[model samples]
Target: MSSYEEIASPADLHADCQAVSHRLQEAAVRATRPAPSIHFDERRREVPKRGIEISEAAQRLANALHLHLD
Candidate 1:
């Protein structure tokens, strides 16, 4: 059964709650850590597409992340 349904008694409910909380905490910690740099030398690589256009939202996100996707 799912976590919300597995709780048979009021006292045992905390165990499920703690499990979910711990999982969320672990996920948060993993997200905060820096990932290894992914090197992609696609400067000269050509795509099948005729042209590409950067979206306004993507530009904003790049600026916010201090990334230069030029």
Candidate 2:
């Protein structure tokens, strides 16, 4: 038997084609429609201060490495 015979029937293929066509139509409609507008508040929110403390030995090592690179 050939691959064509593997398919159930022409009716099923027609139904699948119809479903794909419907999805394509829906996608086209969505593509044509304008995107929704996004609104941003003008006011800025305060952020908490954060700091990272490194050991003195690490800082000296980092400085030496930076000087070597330069």
Candidate 3:
């Protein structure tokens, strides 16, 4: 299947959730220590935001399909 299919799959959605959770956990651990470089901290914050955008897109797609796929 195509990359889009893989990403849109329920299985992959679950994997994305796990991956984001791992990233957040790692960021929390890093935050406990001294602050990293400015660039590093900036990229770190972007990670969760990207995940939220993806999740919102998925939700919107699901809602659209639910309304029109019948």
lDDT leader: 1
Model 1 Cα lDDT, one tens digit per residue, 1-70: 6677654786667888899999999999999999865667734467677788999999999989999677
Q: For residues 1-70, could you state the per-residue lDDT of candidate 2 as single tens digits?
A: 7867777688998999999999999999999998665555644468678987777787788888884321
Candidate 2, pairs of clashing residues: none
The full ranking of all candidates by TM-score, starting with the best, is: 2, 1, 3
lDDT per model vs. reference = 0.83, 0.79, 0.73
Each candidate's number of clashing pairs is: 0, 0, 0
- For each candidate in turn, the TM-score is 0.42, 0.47, 0.38
Q: What stretches of model 2 exceed 4 Å from their correct place?
A: 39-70
Q: lDDT for model 3, on a 0 to 1 scale?
A: 0.73
Cα-based lDDT at residue 54, candidate 2: 76
* Predicted candidate 3 versus true structure: per-residue lDDT over 1-70, tens digit per residue: 6656544778878999999999999999988998657775566554443332346667778788884321
Per-residue error for 30 in candidate 2, Å, reads 0.8
Q: Using TM-score, give the best candidate's number.
A: 2
Stretches of candidate 3 off by over 4 Å are 1-7, 34-70
Where model 1 places Cα greater than 4 Å from the true spot, the runs are 1-7, 40-70
